[model samples]
Target: MKLSQLLEYDPIIVQCHDNPDADAIASGYAIYEYFKEHSKNVRFVYSGRNAIQKSNLLLLINYLKIGDVLEHIEEWKDDEFEGLVVTVDCQYGAGNVTRIPAKYVAIIDHHQKEIENVELSEIVSGLGSCSTLVWRMLREEGFDLDDIKINTALYFGLYTDTNSLSEINNPFDKDMRDMIAYEKSVIIILRNSNFSLDELEIAGNAMKNYLYYPKNRFAVIKAKQCDPNILGLISDFLLQVAEVDEAIVYNEWPGGFKYSVRTCVKEVHADELASFIAEGIGSGGGHIEKAGGFIRRDLYEAKFKDLDTEEFFRTRIDEYFDTFEVIYASEYEADISKMELYAKKKIHQGFVIAKDILPIGTPVIVRTLEGDIETEVSDDLVFMIGIKGEVYTNHREKFERSYQMTDIEYLSDDELLKPEYLPTVHSRNDGSVIDLSKHAHVCISSGATQICACQIDKRVKIFTKWYTETYMAGKPGDYLAVRTDDPHDVYIVERDIFFRTYEKME
Candidate 1:
């Protein structure tokens, strides 16, 4: 339903989810503004156990001028209030949201859950954030958000919900971000605010005790009781490891298992992985790179009394690896401290060492949809000899055996670097820098390819506009010459080397 139809009720009460986040609060505020402009009496209120605890939220509330308008649900006196209740960023009776007992007018939410007893409900599951839904409503009514604070608030809500716009999958979310010129300075500040001291401690402990499984190149951690947001933070931290392409961090809460999955590897999509892991046991879904969900442990146990819950999760993840198809799986000695230091160093450098460089003239194969093409190793660059005979080369990190090419094969001394191989043109087209950074770490639709470079083991560099001087890098599927957020920057690599490699794997 549109705002015009919802505004028919006077003195409408806007209910937000309990323990509201930026999306929840900003959504309620947007509705309040729309109704207030139309000369309707509306109050934005939320009911929850904790007040806004995140420091960034405190800053957002003050900077966006939303403090005075939002009210605690307890502040409302039933005798003095009379109007239909409208919920935003939450469903009427969802466990995470507060349910108001009164005449219900409407429900506007972005989550996949459904609710009952709502007359006017606008539930669009594809939206990255509920704020996007509210923004659409107000903008549709010919309302201009001339207020800088409101615009910033709306933008902040969407940015955080979508993980700095990294999680957005729909045009609606993208359009909402583009609707107004949001203050990037504020966003950078806000993005760093969600983590609390307690949460940081949890992350530190989780990382310290992390279980690094070499068999699958995964970092798994179990934390004490913590906020759902903390899981995301920890998962992001784990992905920084060079060996760990995917990170799965979770905690057991009162209800069930709350988990967050993150990946910088080109062959693993966190959203799909989460869904696959939670299948038949609980509910899970999210964006391609970043996603999360919960599994009702009680319900799962009821259905599978003979299975261990933790084992169930692990087995599912292994199944996903087999199905997704990756290049080669080599075992590594589990090294927690080494990974910790590597993860720490990458933040400063913006890149990490991808693989050991092979000696010059060492033979390696770059897998393609058509077939594997052979090439020589490079010390400082990734080289791909096209089937039609075009040679592609870039900075060393751009070439990873698991992500950029195929397995390393020994060639006799008589075999030369220039084997008589056909150089067919790569099927994938080139992309600008912005397109590259947006998909930098997510899994490719196809399996990863292991590209061989020099024989020396060294640190791999990752560069962006402000990062290292090098521009292009390799992703999972296929393609070369990717541009990032900086218009001037670009990453070049060969395509289809890893794409569909799983199907061709022996």
Candidate 2:
């Protein structure tokens, strides 16, 4: 139906966008008054609720007796608005109005065109404010605006929609002039619209975790579940941060995430970007410069489970720095090979050898630069060996109390020759003696010698002068033989465990 046909209907319902903002409310009221002058059955409706921060507008609305035209669907009479439904400031099925029936006759808005099938649609994308469009319509119809309440409503509609005239460029000066001529007190509106502490806290938390991606020319923030009004607050705050071209806020909601994307980049479309991110995951659509979307929690977790947030940002930053690579070539290419080599060597030599063997028991000895330190055999230290080594001794009782082959590894001769050994050596059970050739650094244990007695008892005397002569010949990674009186118990000690002399000979 045309505007003339829509005007012919009885009990017309004038609806605005869901959760009507100042522009939506003002434009809705302006149309409400226009229709009320010609008809008595007109009613106004909004899709969702408003916040307490909009108290000033609410007061103005109540004072102007606009509440008389307002009627929530739940409060509507069964025979209400059967003639026509005229939607202003929003289109039907645009996610802005809830439960709009198939009878919508006209839509007047300043947003991008939606609801292609409307009988009459007036979407002025060039207009800075939806209220301005309503003002134009009222003027074109020669409606006299003698009431201060109507002027005040139109003024707020223009001012708030333009973000107090901060959003429009200088080219829109005539529009600004027309808005200023209405003479709305901005200070009064702002002062009366102060947000509560809870609202302020919600905005503060959103800004704290803000992350910027210069390559994408966007900033992303995570906001707590909050009033939808806070989306505007976050966008405003992000615009003030230096160098940010676009701001996107993801707010956590029940089982899903809601996103509000805004940008000053005229060439970069926010709605396109929002749609791209929401594709195949959720739904989103809005004006070219500003858009919002929602993603379910399951979808987000599944897609980003492997993402490391810190590394993700670091990689983006690194990509940004890639653009200026030639400017810092020398600093970026400095060698780190020395540090890597040192780390590799340290890991190779730091090995542990268990003192007593048990399927899984305590009392393990870990050999490090400090010395052989005793510790318990636990799952924590099980990964310290290359392969398991076996130990054998004729004095089974002595071996049980004194030695465990739970772990072992090679060390440099200098590391193994330290006289400052641990004071907790176990007593040897066999009384034996060994002759050490100082020149050759050789130690040969025999059943008749004191080494045999030392094996039986824990206390043992080492002839260091002769032992070093025979054992201190080898380099860092060789093996040596440690013979026992029991031929079945003989095993070879790693050459790296011997002194430099023996290691070098091998």
Candidate 3:
């Protein structure tokens, strides 16, 4: 999983998916550079029916002189590779990557898990690009990223993979964009050289004919097999129409279909819709306004059983809008007659004083598995770390009223604050990452007043009073609760968390 693990093998081969894009090349290049720097023999190569012919990719390679180390391998003299083979941006043995036999196989990918069971693998599907994964891995190993070529390649990889960063939502992806000191002029040239004349014609033809569903004010277009970024371009352009609030554009490729989703309406988040379209079959995620996904053809065939792809998309989109109910917490009133009163159980939690960590008025981003929360450090701003290691903000006044600080230390036991991914705080001004757990101290609830709550039967997107900009998603069986003291103060409690921390009041 870590870059250091691969150092055991010598003469390592770094391979990318066939028809390598900027992301694949960048990821492979980073790994190659890391191994090379460590004095390990490594060669970055890609094997497929076609070589890198895309104009933008060619420009990127030429500008960085990566072609010096990168090889377009077609034929192999040896029946099997002797050393370790590390597949980047694509899983080993997947339809997308050519199966190069090796003594040891490792996968570094940022796609839906298609090929599993490999011992050496690092795949985070939520990331916009594999480059971010490699960057993080290299940084963990203390690999130097000061080289201009590597930095620029990594930046372009993320830029192209996330559709010029418009679709990037993951905090890690954002961190890479922020941390990398890349060549802006080179990136501009590579971006401008993205579309070739043939691709431009394909986009033009694809846009001329589109399916518009008036009821939903959405458009879906199936473009000719082209670069995945072209799908984003088509969707973005289509969404500009007066009647269209959302656009879905997709294209079929070698092993699967790549699609892009765009939305301008707050009621519908593009990332949520993108995930909905690819549920169970693939992976999808990005920013609220723009997002994209990939659906494996094999998975699609197995599930849909010969269903038309377009028809399936139409049905899927309809289901997305029909399945969820939206709630604006400020206006909705809780019906206490039907809901039971539930009070917070006395549970040990953690808290961090804002002023203690950073100066007042200093901007900081709280990074969690769920997402990033932006808050400026202030004397009154208190950050509460939940029992699950999740965080919520509170004012000093409310912190004193709702909970009491304890002298106990934050526990490190099985039933306590052992999170899968530990939370961190990053100063936006200085780009410094702070391990949040280090600053946290234990606290206990004051047995806050009961709230009328009930389990939701359907999917809900509630814009809680605290977070008015973005809505919190709640699935069936999740609790929707309204504070008794202030009915307008509404929120959602995850099902497991609700059961773990709350008890019905007698």
How many clashes does each candidate structure show, in the order listed? 37, 52, 0
User: Which scores greater on TM-score, model 1 or model 3?
Assistant: 3
Worst 10 residues of 2 by lDDT: 450-459
Residue 188 error, candidate 1, Å: 4.1
Whole-model lDDT values for every prediction: 0.59, 0.50, 0.84
lDDT of 1 by residue, 186-295 (tens): 87888878777887787788789787778888878888776566778788878888899888888875667778888766556576678777777675666556777677
Rate residue 145 of model 1 by lDDT: 76
Comparison by lDDT, 1 against 2, better one:
1
Error of 3 at 276 (Å): 1.5
In terms of TM-score, which candidate is strongest? Answer: 3
Error of 3 at 340 (Å): 1.7
Q: How would you order the candidates by lDDT, starting with the best?
A: 3, 1, 2
TM-score of each: 0.54, 0.53, 0.83
Order the candidates by TM-score, highest first — what do you get? 3, 1, 2
Residue 238 in candidate 3, Cα distance off native in Å: 2.9
Report the C-alpha lDDT of model 2 over 1-506, residue by residue, as the tens digit: 22344577776778876556677877888888888888658878875543323555556567567665565452233543356677787786665465556344678887666567775777665466777777777766777766666777766766666666666532232343454345356436643574557767888887887887776567877777665556866876796677787777766656556677676753445665565556555656565566666665677668666565334334533443242212121122222232111000111111222222222454433322222233344432321222121111123343223223322223322333322221121212211111111111111121121111001111111112212111122122332122222312211223333332121211
